[model samples]
Target: MANDAIPVRTERAMMRREDNPFTFLQQEIDRLFDGFGRSFPAFAPPQAMMPRMDVSETDKTIEISAELPGLETKDVQLSLADNTLTIRGEKKSEREEQDKDYHLIERSFGAFSRSVALPEGVKAEDVSAEIAKGVLKVTVKKPAPKQSRQIDIKTAA
Candidate 1:
């Protein structure tokens, strides 16, 4: 029985130190968004799922991608206005079975909407969206950089 006992290592494990400011800011932002949906309790859905999305940008274009599993292009609607891009969709599922002793029925429905604020000069015509294999990808062609000019400062008399 003594031979079967395992050895105990007592050395303290190294703890990873993360950048706290960024982490705290991220946590605060997440809390804000989490509360946003529930703020209007009367209109909140019983079941709502927010899709995970990623946004990236380069010199020429801005790209956005969202993971929307079990959803198709027809089920989603995209609109751009006032430099804001919005994605809205509804998911519905129903199952029914009836035979001899019992009848079982299940139903689920949910709607979700998310919007992203684009930078200035992003035109609606320059944006394109496509969904493939449960992933929605949107690309916005960035407009040419405008030349900056200095304005003379005037002092009030």
Candidate 2:
């Protein structure tokens, strides 16, 4: 009898057309609130979306830095309220010459606001902010905790 080898084949996985949960949820919510604009058209105003931020913290202080290129110090606003720090700003572009036509305007403009929660020990009063070279830097000092004294217990005879 002649020996014969059997061939084995591997199957490839089929690509699935699954909808992302976040996108689907957003679409559904938009559909549900489609008539909201019609009911309160006057309440709606054209507003730009908030920019993303990067926050960092240390034992002594918290540091918040945001990218705000082409924005001057006068254009940015920094405030702290109820343990929340907010940074708001607007980017404006003006044509230097009226005769010059802009071929492309890809740069983003308009108002942007971002807020971050201050840590438990942060001192709001001691917070400091500065804008240098188009970057906004905010430093908040951490409050020192009160030291607790050790209590020794004595046994009664």
Candidate 3:
């Protein structure tokens, strides 16, 4: 029994040593590099996901508004299929003059697609989408409810 206890304690001590802060950090760094290698064969850092989206819903409809600065309406596309609404677009920036140098280019210029699941009982035929002022708005209307009929009960004499 004592011999068994000794091995268990030794294993716990070894695990504690392996879990040291420096060792954990080194393991995390190795894991990150390994993930990067798997994700990017050319050893390039992974790009970040797009920013958050703003969605609004009312009793009658759902409205999705996305801020896409420097993007034209021609560059955007909206579609609905299989109860999923997808918004795809691209942002391209061109130099106005060849002699001018761009000191900073923080805006992203790439294709992006965002999809949202449509709720049940939504009227897909009544969906409307619009883009204005660099903001894309999608509206999906809810199905109209069935009208209820009043029932009158006769009083017993």
Candidate 4:
């Protein structure tokens, strides 16, 4: 049997889609910020050190997942108010060795905060948070869906 296979074209590293002006502008802006971060690490915003988060919504609940590395539950704090969930935590460095030669200190040890807007129906009082491994999960209960009703029309007599 003869082998017959067609070659599939794949995107190259240099072939980026920058036709949209906004996309180009966004890329340029991101590059500018990257330069700033590399140049002035200490001047970076506290929120930049905050862990990244993802939010998802369902019919009756809102769930949020955050990547919080090297943090115990005691080191983290959370609060919710006015339909906004605020996450606060500090990454502390424990250097117990006094005579050990230090070569590099790249770990970040500072307080960081992040706030997330809750959906319309979320109940602030009915919220729960859990920390497992290096991830933090938050769940907020939303109001129940309204029941539909029908009304009969009456003729004027």
Among these predictions, the greatest lDDT belongs to 4
Whole-model lDDT, candidate 2? 0.73
Regions more than 4 Å wrong, model 2: 1-49, 96-103, 146-157
lDDT of each: 0.79, 0.73, 0.71, 0.81
Q: Rank the candidates by lDDT, best first.
A: 4, 1, 2, 3
User: TM-score of predicted model 3?
Assistant: 0.58
- The TM-scores of all predictions, comma-separated, are 0.58, 0.57, 0.58, 0.61
Models, CA RMSD each: 13.8, 11.5, 6.7, 12.4
Pairs that collide in candidate 1 are none
Off by over 4 Å in 1: 1-48, 99-109, 149-157
Judged by TM-score, which candidate is best?
A: 4
Q: Candidate 1 residues 1-157, lDDT tens each? A: 4565786544433323354567678888999888865765434455446777999999899999987887899899999988899998987665566576965323334677889999888888999999999899999998888999999999999
Error of 4 at 62 (Å): 1.0
Q: What does the lDDT read for residue 40 in candidate 2?
A: 52
List residue ranges in candidate 3 displaced over 4 A: 1-21, 24-51, 93-105, 121-125, 146-157
Number of backbone clashes in candidate 2 = 0
Q: Over the stretch 1-157, how does candidate 2's per-residue lDDT look in tens digits?
A: 2454864443422323244566678888997687554445333334433555678888888888888888889999888787788888888876455555554444556787888887666656789988888788888897787789999999999
